[model samples]
Target: MHTVVIGGGVVGLSCALALAERGGDVTVCEAGTLGGGSTGRAAGGIRAQFSTPVNVDLSLASVPVWESFEERFGVDVDYRKNGYLFLAREEETAAAFEANVEMQTARGVDSRTLSPAEAREHCPQLRAEAFVAATYCPDDGVADPHSAVQGYSRAVEERGVDVRTRTPVTGLSPPESADGPWRVETPGETLSADYVVNAAGAWARRVGRLAGVELPIAPRRRQATVVEPETAMAESVPLTVDLDRGVYFRPEREGTALVGGHFADADPDVDPDDFSESPDLAWTAEAVERAADAAAYFGPETRVRNGWAGLYAVTPDHHAVVDEARPGFVVAAGFSGHGFQHAPATGECVAELCLDGAASHVDVSALSLERFESDEPGTVEQNVA
Candidate 1:
């Protein structure tokens, strides 16, 4: 069957690859260059320490691909298994952390709750006195987002998928009947597809509307900065998160760390086409200050090297909407910030949805858009940084 996948980011390319591998004709339509959107700006964090089982399952299914990316895709994504440490300052938050650890562990994740002192073992500079509890998973780490994108792009091309860069889908028309074809219009040409996958990250809502579906996906601006700390951070240092303050810092190099978070009380949505790509100077300064508060690595002498801003296609509950919105139309967007890491698993699930009419690999039923319309939604993932 002919499938036109929208958004040529990592997730889009992945879905195309999976579909192509399953003996389907696939074409990828990207508004910009591959990975130039949120994928290129992502921090490349891959972790299984999630608060929900579905998110954890997604991570588990995707991490193995990342772990063996070089062997499978013939590209070195610089996957580092340094680890991820989450810190909770408030007692209530600490209790939540402990509960998350239990859930994660029950789901086969090698995660465990840690005392403040025990957590300090992973990052010696951590202010143990400030945090009441922590969680760590040695298997969680970071990778190169661009490299993964390149790998997926190359793999999809090898599978005979048409990848069109700088080609935006101008319009979309659903199939007239159950057996009809969907029309996908681009600036260059109009393509016919038996199925259409909406993997358009920040602009998913716009794409959904073209098919007469109202997707409640909002684009929220998130920024990150790399700083040369006063004291050199250990290369083995885990990606530490000050959960209460929404600050997260992971070692970038021997003496440098990448710091980022949402510190503002109000997170207003931004236009994906017009937002600034560079990080704000004031926000960078505040990120460093917050990082210092979490740990002593960032001192007064810490210098901001560089940073960039990206958009997170956020949903109301911070979980991705991976479901078939209608027959022959699949929506796999609103990853909030986990798109890069979860791309592999989501791709497989999308392929299943298109080919088998359901996802057999993972239970993504709770990720459907209709859940938001009901009174009860899925569990909210609280580990978002």
Candidate 2:
């Protein structure tokens, strides 16, 4: 089967690679350079600590792929399994963490709840008195987002899949009949494919409109800042999150760390084409302050090195819309902020839907666009970062 994938982010590249591996003729068209979208700007976090079973299953399926990425793709993605620590400061949030741990543990994730003292033991930088409880998963970690994107791009090209950068898909024509192929239009030429996968990150809703389908994906701006702390941070320190404050920090290069979080009532619905790419000074100051409360090493003396803003294709439920939205068209977008970590499994599922008419690896039927048409849309995923 001939398949055309829209968007050139990590998810789109992975889908193309998986399709090529399945012996399907594939072509990937990106409007800009590879990984130029939200994928390149991602924080590179990979974790299985989730409140929902479907998300946990998706992460579980993707973790092994990330672990063996360098060996399989011949590119070192810098996969670091240091871990992810989530701190809860209030009783209600602490109870939620307990429930999340129970849900994650049932899904075979080795996540355990810890006391404030125990959490501080994992990272001496953490302020022990700031939180009531925490959750830690030793296997959850981070990787190089750029390396992963380039790795998958090369792998797909090696498999004879045509990857066209700077080739923007202007329009899409769904099949005229049951047996007709979908017509994909570009500025230079027109192409036909048996199937089309819409993996357009922040522009997924627009891409869906081209096919006469309406998707709930909206672009929300998120920013991250790098701080050079006055004190050095231990390399073993995991990515720590203050769930109550909506702030997080993780060790970056030596003596530096990356910190970011959303402020209460600060979430902005941004135009994917026209939003600030640079971080705001006020938001950066707030994020750094929150990070300092979570980790003592991120003191007030910490200097901001740099920062950038990226868009997250947020859905109403804050989960991914990963299903066949239209006949001959498959969607794997609107992951809120979890797209990078879950791209591997989502790609496999998209390929499975295109080739086998069903997804066996990870069942994503719950993420269908049809769910929104009902009175109850879908479950809101609580572990978004």
CA lDDT, every model vs. true structure? 0.92, 0.91
Error (Å) of candidate 1 at residue 15 is 0.3
For candidate 1, what is the TM-score?
A: 0.99
lDDT of 1 by residue, 1-385 (tens): 9999999988998899999999999999999899999999999999998888889999999988998999999999999999999999999998888888888888999999899999999999999999899999999999999999989988999999989999999998888887999999999899999999999999999999988889999999999999999999988999898989989999997679999888874689999999999999988988899999999999899988999999999998889999999888899999997999999999999999999999988899879989999987667777456
lDDT of 2 by residue, 1-385 (tens): 8999999999999899989998999999999999999999999999999888889999999999999998999999999998999999899989989999999998899999999899988889888898999999999999999999989988999999998999999999988889999999999989999999999999999999999999989999999999898677777888888988989888898878888778764466788989999999999989988888778887768999999999989888888999988889999999987899999999999999999998989988888888889996566776436
Which 10-residue window in model 1 sums to the lowest lDDT?
376-385
What TM-score against the true fold does each predicted structure earn? 0.99, 0.98
